[model samples]
Target: MNTETTNTERSTQIMHTEKQIEFDKIKNIWKNLAITDYAKECIQNTEICLDEVELRNRLRDTTNSKEMIEKLGTPPFQNITEIRDIMAIGQKGDCLTPYQLERVERVLVVVERLRDYLSRGKQFYNSLAYYDENLDALPELREEINMKIRNDGVDDRATDRLFDIRSKMISVEESMKQKAEQTIRNNKECMADTYYTLRNGRVCVPVKKDYRYKIQGSVIDKSSTGSTYFVEPAGVAKQYEELALLKIEEENEVYNILYTLTAMVIYAIPVMEENMRMIEKLDFIFSKGKLSVDLDCVEPQINLERKIELTKARHPLMDKSISVPLDFKIGETERGIVITGPNTGGKTVAIKTVMLNAYMAQCGLHVSCKAANISMNSNYLCDIGDGQNISENLSTYSAHIKNVLEILKEVNKDSFVIMDELGSGTDPAEGMGIATAILEELRKSNANFLVTTHYPEVKEYADKTEGIINARMTFDKETLKPTYRMVIGEAGESCAFYIADRLGMPKEMLENAVTAAYGKGAISNYKFKNDNLKKKEVKNVIIKKRKYHKDTKLSTLYTIGDSVMVFPDKKIGIVCEPVNEKGVLRVQVADKKIYINHKRVKLLVKSEELYPEDYDFSIVFDSVENRKIKHDLDRKYTDEVYHYDIEK
Candidate 1:
């Protein structure tokens, strides 16, 4: 029951599978639910567990987290990026800043709160409590960090020398300020601006430049023009020197305190790392539980018997209000399902739903379903959309055939494969032939598979083959629309004639299409009424041709493709569609085609005189982009067209 893959090979396959099923969209949802970037990374890097024990443990943890969240509120694991960055710096033998030490204490406090929160329900939520034990709050270090650092600075209580030095600084600073004020009062006449100011952390008095040496110990500062000078008296100078020495002592003591705190943080780094990992694991588990709740998902039964039964399963990525729920099964008497339906039906979605649920279940996530029973698979292989690679020079058919060949090589009973519109993008007869052959091979391999196709021949093969079931997305014949509801054990008709008739195609054309498809009306033509179209109908009538009024009508004056200038507007245009007998000529002006009386327009150039005998006028009439796209399709096959919905 162990299916764990190893190293780069497994990683490549996991990413490939994710791309095929668009698992990143679901992964995005899971990542956003997490509180911390660490938990988001855990979701981004995790792969599906194929081993029974590993898979079950993941599911069990998620289940326990969900129950714990509902009963005991969410665990408080706040996002703490600073904790990791500071720890890294501490590891490099660098002393942490006071701010970083404070952040460390904050994280530790949260860890302690989370630990106590989970421990309360240990007897009932033991699985959740396991992670709680891994969270080492380190209360002793937490208390130490908080006590030493307060408000992003070393507190006085941090060290006795720091306290004593700071007290001395305050007293020296007061005494220096008093001495500065007294000197300013005595030298009022010699002062330049009459103020005592601090320069380089020393008290100085502004003095007139002419009286610089009158009362001074040292010049501390001067004005830009040399009109004024600053001096500190010798009496205050000695006391100022003592104050500076005490300030240096205070700085040294603060550095010592910070060094000791940094060492303590470094010592606790290992335990903090363990605590972070535990928090991330818990965050990741809670995110899964939150997704289950947000999507209203259910945890399904898992077994190793290769049997999958889903009742009312939904595609998690789709809008539940509009999308139809799928009811499907496989890996039992029938290991393969061949889905046949009209284009744009829910065939591809239904197949993807089955594969996505199995993939999620293997990842230990809940399935978006009312209820289900699923099995572990060694691999989830799929080729759901067009795999065309222009750089690789692979056509749609070539890409599909290559993917099928690779799938054939890897599939076994323990594998689950979903193929959408297989054997498409090629000749219908050849595609159906290959589709049937691949289905037969899959049946023989005993691998559970779901494939959708529009080929009737493949449907017939599924109908007659043993251990293969035929399903179809239901169609409404009256409305000519697909119901998008899958019905098992039924072969669906293409209903091409019904759809054509509904779209206003002539009855004769529908009959011709029916004859060509079913061999001369092998099946009855669908019944449709012209009256049900609910529009006005004209009855057949005959009339004589209009009599010529020679004087009343304007004579034809321009040939088709001749450029003409219309009167009044002075706009030039190209003449198109020949001038009618009544002298009304069709002309193209820019992108619009207009009809004007020939008398109001005069030909500027003759069709024969402009260029050659048979020039293509559409070059001027058609857009440049359209001409370019047409040229591309003419040279080689391509799906890109200027306006596909209009032209085709």
Candidate 2:
């Protein structure tokens, strides 16, 4: 998939569907197994196996083995990638630690046991028949490491000399303890306490501070109060040094053994990696099978027809007992679906259900439905939420548009798209127009898409469009509630006023709203006249003429060259002529002349009030160049000014 579609799927929350919930549940189950990080990655990136044979094989394996695997209990597997890395290094002749070698032994032992267990059923179970027993279990290597390294990570009796050294060290330590005890008894009077202790890995006697000279030993540690001395007697100091040297030799011997064992395992790295991979694949398969059992899901029929038919489908995350089962189909009969309904009527949920199930089926996981027939698509994209980005200065509409634009570029016959509340968050007329155009483009592209909207025009377009069909969420007018049932081939009503009346809104207001929405006859069925009917009817009447105060009359207040502000448009302009009999005035705004309704224009400054009584009116209505030309002409012919003024 392209990054744009991938990002759209994630950002739209289309991937965060019921299947994701199922995926999470399966992940939680695998957590108990403590699988390797490599195995976890394999599981996480598991995609829809488009190959029919491979997909069916996986489903069959899971279905056949889920019970047997559950009875056998979860396999005990530890993440061994680190151990594998150490083995890789050891292959280069580098020494490994005792604990690292022990881990290698443990992993081999587990793999060997798991392999045997799986191979045992190869003849008895079809699921186990896929197990390849020919893969090397590395049994000899495991035994060799086991013999060299103890479970506690200490070197066992692998070398005769190392064993002899440890034995001699233990004997020497016992003798040193006895010597210290005898010394403590001989110096009982000088000792602070009648006990011997080991300090700094050497046997010591706690001697009184004042009698310290009597001990004939070197002080290793002093008591906090300086009342006693922890002394390593000069007599057993040589034995302590010998034991320390023996430990160093033992460590070197253990390292040599570990390095040898690590190298042996490293020789079998290819087989070991293969074995780990097989086990991980098995774990992932069994996990999906276990999830299927838990969710009561069934393997769906996969096809290349670019269609889906779901019967009694429920969102996987919902409570099956109460979740409304939906019968949704697309791609076969119609390439696009336009879902229309009022708010809280399950339109969004229905679209989400289709998207989630399609995704799950494509991912090779059984969907939570009675039966499903799904087709694979190359890309799945959705625009389902208010994708507002404040950092980019994008509003909800802009964000939706941006997503749609990306979708338009990527959509094809093999793509599946789900969009929620298309053409929302803007003016209804233009929003509907943009939504229709998008739908037309999607149809032309031949991609499968599902969209929800409240616009009636969109619903009409869906009805008339060839490849699109209309569906709605059923609403109960009597109960004033949504039934949450999706009914295809129908258009849903908003029922706003009816629901409002049922919610105890004022009846007269609801009646007026209904009449306004539908027609005067919409509420004619009501037997009683509304108490506020006369008042509303009076308010609706249009007056042909308005009585204004003499001072506010437009004809008397406005004159030529007056500055005024026009209503509605709120533009300021200078009046070029007096108000006509029809209450119209000619106004000059900049270089443009416009006719204004006299009543809608408010007089700001009368020409007589702003200028001298004899000021020329041409300057106010003409450009600066024209006024200058007129001024120069008048200077040349002052007598002709009277003639020009008369002609004007």
Candidate 3:
């Protein structure tokens, strides 16, 4: 295989397939099982591996870890995941703080323990013991660090120079105390206290404020109340200065000791860093084992041939009790399966389970199944879910179309693809056409895939195609619920009519719906029965009429009798019609009834305020001759009425 091409394809697959299969969720599970931050980071950056030897090696290590834990108990893997920065500090020529050095010591201790643990069972765990060869014990550095450092500070015996400096400072401090005692006794009457105390790193005797000037010493610090002063005895003043010098020397020696230890650590930085990496790798390996035990997983039989056969496979995220176990296969005879089922019938879950299992197995983790005979693929591409991009103003169907187009561009025989609800979220006729054409194109690509659809025509195409098979999520008509079982070599009913019938929809309407779906004669041939159970059956019942309170009052001034001015025409006319749903209105403009939009007509006057109650608008709207013809028609029959209507 071309390395560049294979890497490019895997990158694309990781970009698109993670969220669709919730692979990150599985990673979170792995992360939680890990004892070290190193392992967690390793898990986060893991790629879906397809290399046969590399994948087998990782799985073998994981299996070894699982057995090692079962027989020998948990390996003493410390949570010293923060060793990277500690090593970086030493490598950058900075002295490691006592705390940070202890962390490095911790890493070394864990390495030693793991080696010993694996060695004790070397006869039984030869593979596990193989890591001991590359691992350098680095006993000199470990022992030096352990001896020189404490939890909080460097030990006094860390260096001979530091030890001598501290010893001389102690002797000088004792001599200063003896001299201060003599001065306090000679000036007992002037002393504020009998004991000598420390003041500015010098032994001092507290004196009364009035007698501070009389004391044979220099005042260093005074009490807050100003009644007493801390004075250094003049005899010990020179000795205090000498002890201070020794203290400075002590600091320099301590730094020298720390620097020497850090130099040794820096020399071994390369080894320790490599050791840290190995420890992290071992942590990740054991974590995979822990996840295997938690998920009750089995090693999948990875094959070079692109065939998938899984038995009793459950989605790793779902509860096993509630989730239906899937037995699915492809690439043996059929290259693709067209799944047809009603809504929420596990069609989506069915495909997702198969895809996620194949993904996990390829990554060298045990799959959650009794048996997973899987194949390695260059990439697994799926265009599942709505993924509606609201910010970009893309609809569900538009998103699906975009994703499917992108998937189609990168599909191949080594590619495992899954598409759900193909040709949905659009006009049925056009969507079905686009779906069929896309399927044919996919067939040409020879990619092993699974497609779910509600289009009956797609089902027919699957039945006739040689490399395609028809599958369905079984539904129970009697219970009006889905069984959530996948059956091969059969097509499924949408069960819309049965569900509607059970929901109290009239039988005639369901029959009409069937007719509309499959055309006129399909209703008689449709297989469904009306539930006659009186308690559960739908019954015709009279509904009570209601008038809800209206919240919005009309603001428009167009009334039947109101005078309105027509725009551009500038003719005054009585409003003869109310605004319709289209906002069109009728206005009698001088016996020529004009049809115009409401926007063109404006209210000129209020009829209720001007016209009297029960007023006859004929005086304002009709001519005298036309009124006489209307009065004649109301009292007696006449052909003159036709002339009146035609003239009006």
Candidate 4:
């Protein structure tokens, strides 16, 4: 029997990654838990002389049945007697002693002889009673013999011979098994029902309840009542007395056996520890299972429900209690989101939500999503929040610039990038100008990027430029707390005066500050500029890029004229289009249509058109090989290149 299949796989299959960690934590807390499992395995593996449940009963045998219930919680079996009759002695509330067991053994010898004689006669007696046509008792043979001899009133030789045989049987009867006879050599009839012996060649018989008569003998004893007798034959009487003590000795041996068995309970301590550890792990897994986020809306659906999916993703440090569930998918034509919101509005969490979920999915735990449908870039670049290095005496704006510079060096056309607080910690004019410039460079670089910023200038860039969009986190002035919700196509309203007034600032001072900054016209100009930027919206380049991508794919598919898969990142397609060159189908794809690979493509045919052995559908990806290439400047950048060739 493969215990491994049921016991090992079942125990491990219930655990997720987090649950495994939880189990480790529990082991640290209680080391003995591992031992508990080992103990259980030991019991299970022990030789089963009895049935499993019966063996369990024997192992738990005890004199005090009440203590059994208290300690083990439940008896391993219903009644210990079901496994053996010894349990009955315990039920009588009198513990068996060794002396009693020895006595029983001696008594059983006599019982055994009687049982053997009856066994031999049983078949014949049963046949006479059941097999005959007329079942009747045997005729009176003794009376017939006596009557025959008496009726003749003569000296009958045959009658005389029978009487002689009967008288000799009492004096000369013997057993062939001398050893068995010797064990019961001291023959005593203490009573018609009970027997007792003494050293004085005396035996007592109890003829009436609680009344006894003694018999004394020279080599043999006769009762005073003459109803029962005894025999004393030297050492035989002492041997017989020892036989009577056998039952008690055996009972004591049984108690010793059980005492040794109970010592094995020490092994159970570890088993309980291990069980407790596993229990705690189970608790943690179930606790995570209890999270009820709005993941249903993000369930992966085929083409019609196509969207970016970030399942059960969260800010790694935020406790589960304060965590907010954020879900959004860009509709068709809504790429390049611009998140604009007040401070502490969960902007950072939202950004991390996207990044960490992608990382987690790559590592292969089923994402926290009800369903996940995602289109991913082959590469990713992140320019998240960075604080200025005081040791270098660098300002925040300088640090931000250095981070963006590093980001620009690595980003490619097929990369996804996230930038937090895109322009900040510098002169307002300079920061806004640099922010718009960076967006322009990113747009031309052909990378999908997300940027968060407070600058109105950055928002204006989104409205005026193609392949860009604006978004904002919602705020409630009445509550003065961020709702942590995003609304697309809107810029965050900076309500400085309103907040100052709510915070118990003098109303007159707030009014004066607002008038000094705005003069009513500055505020009007702000709205006008925003409205103008919306009017100046240009054709989004991402829409054009998607259209071109769709066209390229359609063209390649058309050329092949048969079903195939496209690796868009590498701009390659494996065609079933047969050609004379090497007599193999040519893989044709475009370099500009980046990321399509031969590994991504497959030969498709109707099931009825192929046999099981006809085709191998497994696709193998090529290992990247470094190739040094010459540039116009005679300098070379070592490029890791990959190419595919059909094996069959």
Candidate 5:
């Protein structure tokens, strides 16, 4: 085959394989971290938690729901279907609605109430509780006593005694009120001056003028502002008065309230936190649930368990019923499996089945296997098939060489590698030589590999190497369809003549070609079968698989609004429409939607993909919104399809 033809075939195979592992439910084991019952219920119901308010508050407070969970513990609130549902009735965006804003105000009100109750618990003897103005009437009391004496209510000696007593009363009252006022003022200032800012090269209160003097002492500079006052320096008398009120008994009451409220709010942290974590998981599940695929007769597995076992798998890209699964195995002694069969004998599909499934499994996706027991090393390398990138100024030969080199770099004694056709871009002698050398290297490396080749050199290697083996996709010449089945230890027999006859090739032309090919030794170059493998047989097998899928009825056929499952894995996707005439169901996952055939759709079985083995999950406490950048390719490349930045 020409290099161009080979490249095209390879690219087609790879594209198909990639499509097989649908991207949306492409195996995210991270989701299992949410192991709590609340999380499981949410996923199972395909319902999101409405815990937006809790999360919003945590975010506003520069905290996360998960953080609180570590300190305080789990939440107490029962799961609400939607925390944001009520808000949903409101408009969305950065701004809040009247009702939403009211909620915020209520939060602030609660804070104020808490502060009030704390203040009321203060003790009479507590320095912080003393009222200063009431304590400053000593002088006035003494004056009143003197005035009474002047009114001639008593003798001169009596008046002197009364005046002395009044003087003493005035002195004591002034001391009490002065000290109480100073302590109260200090507390008020502490609350008021909680925040500050820098302005015009001065450290100033970050409040309005009215609040400034109370919060931060009035500035003494006269040049300061239109509204300015000087606060008298607090003195020793004021300090003594504050000290007199410092009784532990009195202070304890106020501390008790502070401690109680803090404990109450802090205690609710875990529950609130749990709800928030659930909401995040819900968002992810819902977002991912949008894409859906179908599963049917495709059961392809890896031979890690001495025998390969795969069941009910589907092509990720093809409409549901069209994907067929083939089950077979190659042994350890067989280092390489060479698959060959007639044209359209599902040679490509079988090759893709092995390669793509391996890729998906490594990437963490659940495979389309009912029982999958794949034992594979970490490194997965593939040169399945790719068309040459003409735009890259590389020809088929060059692209193949590059791909081979890339694969070789990663291949090791234990690596699993799949190569479609080793070398086919040049002359037959040179091509066979290159293919033979490559096979020799792979065999020597003792790596587990699979390759599809029409070259004699590859077949020869399979015959000679102890660990190498040959497998062929069976083509019943009587049935025109490639049976899509596999057979081990057999060299594939080409049915070219049979195919030509079935397709109604001209008798004279067929005869002439056969003679020419035989004379060229092409007929004897490899095995060829001349028989009738009717198309009807191929069609029947496909129909049978489809019927099996249909008869295996999922509990419900998804409708426009119903939630559905995307497969090869179970993911929540919303059904956008019922099955169309072609048996294809359309669904949306996230922002993307595509039509899938019915065979792949199944009633959501268990809600989760059970983990493979011992797994540890860490709780994630943050949310990140998806970032999408729309690229206008046409606009970006106005002059060319491919642009290279030589200058850069």
Candidate 6:
């Protein structure tokens, strides 16, 4: 398949999964050291294969001879994108400059070196020499270019005539310098500093401005202060002109040599292009080998049968120091696995490890595991994270369902799907039903799938369903912490109360929550009734509420008249009622009243400090005018104004 198609498939397969990020990270490492853009592109487009003998052979060759390969180090492969342009130019009978030809020469040297390196050991690197015949080596071309071009990219001693022309130019220029120096010495009395300098590419003498007419020559330049005049003596003018002409001839000769070399390279473009492809392929292979070594990876055995047996597999992108190694399996006796675990218990990490290793195996790279026996699937699919699309106005559940629909449409018998927290983010009952139905469909198609969930009903379904098994992340009940270990054939219990208690939740509150979830009976008892052993007696058990001892200091912390601010809600209120059995206080804010946990309200004003010994609470609880109106209404109300509002 083409790269676009492969990328689209992988995008859908691991789009919401952690493997998406992990894959990019792996590709980035390869791109960083890649010699050319084409080589980097090859790394990106590498895909898993099932029956590619040549690819496997190359991988084996590199892996087997890694040490020897490392000895050669990285080859000097330069960017050759402009080579195509140069070739096009030469095809139209145009010549290339020395700079362009130098680049081509450098590439040829690299190609020749790589070919020689690989050709050294005929057995180990034999498979990598697939393009050896196509590469011309072009030793003659390399020699000719080296002879004509200097290491600094200028023309060297290539042709005898060009060399002679440069020699004559150098000697004539020296002669001009000597003549100018002699002229300076002869007119030392009229010269400014007795120094000979060059101006306008000709030797000149610095003559004093007052004696400028003493030197009979052309004026070349003058000092900024105008105290001295730079003069090119008439004696050396002809020799300088001859030097310029010789320099022009030298440039022409260099161009001819460059054109000859460029023509030679253009003629061998076909073979050179083939050789470049081979070098890129080799670069890509060695990169994989280097990554394998870096990640402590091992080659996994590929099987036609659908199965994944990963032992001590760790997420390649995670911190190795603290990362938990996963031992997971599928498609042996069971085709579907439902992994139930608490949050942050390595469930997502486990799923990513499986998917990434599978992708790596298919891409012909070694996987990060001690031992792996992975089955080749037609497609690798997953829905492992929040796929929310805010711009599309899609909720997390909608995004998840959209991905599931796409996966369902594309999955086949040889497909592998990994879903994290399946049947979540919606109504528990309906979501569990939908998840069960989807799992049934996947099982019916014989597609290998692994799903993680928090629903008890899903776990029960896995317990009863054929070819489906339940797994869980191990939790330590005493420590109230997850161990991040996956255990098979067991359903995990959600120890919310224990965890909450360890996090400093109130003991009474945790007890009530646990009782509510597990029922009031702390223990179960069996009794026989009606003279039959099968019929059990039913007893009405009453659970007594625990009473708290009222401590004087605690009870007086917030009194009836205390002004307080409710936390989280941030409302100002006065404590109108005493603390209850639950340590919650009833506070009144303006016209509204709310009951808040004692710890959730902060005392702003103490009752003892804010009120008098025999204070009338009505003054603080009600407005002054309302209190006055109540007083008038409570009385006989003899006046008309006070009596008018009594009924209203």
lDDT per residue as tens, model 4, 1-648: 599886664344223211211322222322322123332332223221213344223222211222222333221111111212332443354443333332222222322332333234335442211212221111232223233223322112334444443334322222212322442333223334433344352332223322222323223544676654444433444444554454355434444533322232222224323423333332222112111111112222222222355444444335556776666554246446788888898676576566444332322212344455444444455666665689999877787798688678767665656778887776555677888888888877766677788887788889888777888888777767888877667777665655665666554444434434434334333311112122333332110001125334333332233333342232324343433323234454432122232323443332223324444332212212311122212454444333333332
Once superposed on the true structure, which residue ranges of model 3 sit more than 4 Å away at CA?
1-13, 32-41, 78-97, 121-123, 159-168, 174-197, 506-648
- Alpha carbon lDDT of residue 76, candidate 2? 48
The per-residue C-alpha lDDT of model 1 at residue 15 equals 83
Q: What is the C-alpha lDDT of each candidate?
A: 0.80, 0.74, 0.81, 0.43, 0.46, 0.74
> Between 3 and 5, whose TM-score is larger?
3
Candidate 6 lDDT, tens digit per residue, 1-648?
999998887765654443443787887876776676787888776655656574466447546435445555554456667766777887788887677677777888888877776666355454554545656667887777777777645564788888788889889988998999899888888888767997877788999899999888999999999998999899888787888788889888877777778788887888778877777666776677678767778888777778899999888877778877889889889998888878877777777788888777777778888999888888777886788889999999999899888778878898888888887787665788889988888888789988889887889999999999999988776676678788878877676655765566554444444443444453132111112223234333333322335654455557788767675455778887778767777788767667767866666556766678878776655556666777877786635332222211
**Number of the predicted model whose lDDT against the real structure is largest:** 3
Where's the lowest-lDDT run of ten residues in candidate 3?
Answer: 539-548
Model 1 stretches with alpha carbons more than 4 Å out: 1-10, 35-38, 79-85, 88-93, 123-126, 477-481, 519-525, 529-648
Candidate 1 lDDT, tens digit per residue, 1-648? Answer: 345545665677678778778777889988888999988888898777879998888887777777777778777878866678889999999888899999999999999999887887697846677666678888898888888899999998787888888888888888888887888798888888767898877788888998888886799889899998888877789888899899899889888889998998888888989888777778888988887877778887899888999999989998889878888887778898999888887888888888888888889898999898999999988887888889999998898898888889888988898898978887555677889999999999898999999888898899999989999899888877777889888987787777777788765555544543444445364675442444444442221122236664444456677766675465778887667877677787766788876755655566776659778765766767778888898899888756622311
TM-score of each: 0.77, 0.73, 0.75, 0.35, 0.40, 0.75
TM-score of 1: 0.77
Task: Return the clash pairs for model 6, or none.
Answer: 48-362, 48-363
Which candidate model has the greater TM-score, 4 or 5? 5
Measured on C-alpha atoms, candidate 4 has an lDDT of: 0.43
Better of 1 and 5 by TM-score: 1
Each prediction's RMSD to truth: 15.9, 10.8, 13.3, 29.7, 30.0, 12.1
Question: For every model in order, what is the number of clashing pairs?
Answer: 0, 0, 0, 40, 45, 2
Which 10-residue window of candidate 5 scores lowest in summed lDDT? 618-627
Query: 1-648 in candidate 5: lDDT tens per residue?
Result: 999997786555444334332222333222343433454443333211123343223222212222222233332222333323423432232322323323322333333332332234243232212212111112332232333323322212334444454455456545544543553455553333333333332223323345444433434333255442323224533433443444332334333432333333243334334434534443332222221112211122333333333444444445545666556454445667877676677766676666555454443233454445444443446665554887899878777877777667657765667777667676555677788788787777767777777765567677777887888877766667777777778878757776776677654444434543333334344333433333322111110111235464442344454445565344556565577666777666555666676655553322122222332211011112111111234345433233321221
